[model samples]
Target: MFTSMTVINILLSLVFLYFLGKYLLNMYFEGINRPEQWAGKLKQGKITRELQKAQRQYGDKSRFFLFWLQIERIKKEQIQGTFAELGVYKGDSARILHLMEPTRKIHLFDTFEGFIVADLAKEKGEAASYTPTNFSDTSVDEVKRFLGNSDTFVFYKGHFPESAQSLDTEKYAFVNIDVDLYNPTKAGLEYFYPRLSPGGVIIIHDYSYKWEGLVKAVDEFVRGIPENLVLSPDTDGSVLIIKNSVHT
Candidate 1:
């Protein structure tokens, strides 16, 4: 039983309170997060275009921050090892890894024929859900052409582990595991983890709960291992495991 003026006043008051609360909350978080500080830095009195491009490409500050941080760390530590990608379907990510650290040899491993019978068998669901159809579109020549350089490139165009036989003694500073099925994921982890250089990192895509097979593979692989799984909070659901020990 309120007058029209009273109802309007109450509504305005609530709106004001909402804005005030929002401002206070923003201030509180700003103090702790200091996003402004992390977002920009003085590099010859100008913002770095590389950092800006990374932020725009990722569409998330936190994600770009983590990725940039890792690159900087690897460079600073001078982690000596090659770069590798276990699932080089179209060579998109492989291209980026090569550009990221061009001096390091980048190994591309894949069947280029999609999932094998063994990889499909490791999958729990229907074969249709994890079909091995589309990946056959790519080839080693296509990937090499895309990169436009073969000096630092080494393509393992066959089933993994067997394809990886040539790299038995190879050590990697960065390894990207994008093979969707359980078997390849498991095999990639088993092979890469032991050879990861100290301070190097292995980024496993699809570590999020969405990919149950990948989650299971990563979980089982790292069960009793001493290495820590640092999951990214980004939308891509990537988890990075850093090789901290200098020994092995």
Candidate 2:
């Protein structure tokens, strides 16, 4: 409707105004409020520091940040049941759970070696292709050493879901799945979900990066049990599912 020069000038002015507003908004947010500073610290340094502190204070052999957090939450809620961990690589997480909730019985499941062909197959879509031949470098022994003669904890050696099925426990307040494969994750869920006490918590490790299978399994599991289950924001690929009520 206007002359070409006028239109061009208006457009340039609008762009300038937009940039100016953006700059002012950014500056305002960056200054006294320092919201971005808090966010930056949370994203860059704080989370890592917290996780590291948890690991160090809890003992590196059997402690991971996500698992420890789950234990704290479970105990705070006063949930009633035993605790179990499937796919205990070196038993660090299980050991931490044992220490955190000393009154509760803790079950540790693992092959004590590295991944089996079946584990690799389910995780990587290729059986035996990615199996680790040497477990000498792994952390299983460290977990054992850390727990050294704990009476409240029991270790079950073998493939999971099967080992879990052998567990006679009728109820569990917490279950941690860290097998890193789809089948084990699925199997663990199937085995433990029914045993979970009302208001219990289930934690799946490696649910994010490097373990898409865990995420998929968790997603599908949550879909099937949407009423009482809630997933946590991803933590070291761990996904937490809290059962707020009984499924009936």
Candidate 3:
């Protein structure tokens, strides 16, 4: 029979072997599945700097970083059209878009007075959990100042779909939709998706499980659409719907 010390040593050796095997297997798979762009290195140049500044001002580093990357991809792919933001809460995100593409007309839409009751009615689960009028303190003037008061930026201060009517037949290259409630989120997708240029991007915020209504809205809207949905790997709960390019 084995001694007590020997038995303990054998057990320890078995545990070590198991961990060692797992580590080697993980390393082998990681090497094979390495991405084209290494995650270890920092992204360089103007977009990176702009993203850094945006994260500092807006506090959603991941969202801004991903937005910058998407903008870069759009430029690389030569996607054309204007930019837009549906829920311009304090205009921080709008500012980021303007800074990245100053020449492009960036439309900012919001009531500047908070959510409407009808929109919140589409929300699932407990209604009280949703803040209907949370983003009311901001104004069009405030957004202008926040975005350097640029003429290229247009603010439509009212309910969307209604406010969006004035846009006419304009196509969008990049649109960020952050209307948290179900009705507006679904409405935004309906309005923007048709207008989204081939190769354009539509990023809808709050699509995670935390906002069941928002996810529900996006799911219902994209059912018959040809575009693909990509969920952001960020806590802000954004999702990207990329319009298929004609050339592709």
Candidate 4:
């Protein structure tokens, strides 16, 4: 039943797939076998196996590396407080954050179910295209399992700010705010910045033009704060806030 052209087309498709598969395999093997492109010797490089694991787990190598570097500085400076993540998606960054500093407890907050309808209503740019179900792929249980629910991991499965109501008195050394919309991004700043300890670090992700709402929220928030905005080169871009030292 196969026509001459159809058979030729099938053979061509198979050849293309075979070469494509081989190329991907070669790329992965080459990456694994080579030295990490970011750091040097483990001692001076500060490159642990965990960082390598995080590199593999995280979507943006620079962002994960930025987290690792900032946390190390936090420790060296003896910033004293717990950690918090305003928006956790499948616990990828949260797991790396926890692993980087296992002693510090990490409070994870998210709707887990996904974007709230209200939050998306006024959004613009890349966020306007999203639906309420866009980020609802995984659940709290799935993320918890991924994070191993270790003693240092705490889960708050609901809308943030609302989820953080009981923790008003809590102080944080590190806060990662990754909610993609404007309202939550603004709310995260209002709540976490005041609670952030002196010398604490906060990172708000999605600061690029692709997510105009997030960018606008961060821009407005940073304008009011004493800390200067430090931008990262991560794929989605992230804005960093390092609380001023007590002496400053």
Ranking of candidates on lDDT, top first: 4, 3, 1, 2
Candidates, ranked, TM-score: 4, 3, 1, 2
TM-score of each: 0.74, 0.65, 0.78, 0.83
TM-score-superior candidate, 3 or 4:
4
Best by lDDT: 4
lDDT of 1 by residue, 17-40 (tens): 998986677555444543443445
Winner of 1 and 4 under TM-score: 4
lDDT per residue (tens digit) for residues 192-216 in model 4: 9999889999999888889988888
> Which of 1 and 4 is ahead in lDDT?
4
User: In order, what lDDT does every prediction score?
Assistant: 0.75, 0.67, 0.79, 0.85
What's model 2's TM-score? 0.65
Worst 10 residues of 1 by lDDT: 51-60
Measured by TM-score, the strongest candidate is: 4
TM-score of 3: 0.78
Pick by lDDT: 1 or 2, better one: 1
Worst 10 residues of 2 by lDDT: 54-63
- lDDT of predicted model 2: 0.67
TM-score of 1: 0.74
Per-candidate clashes, comma-separated: 0, 4, 0, 0
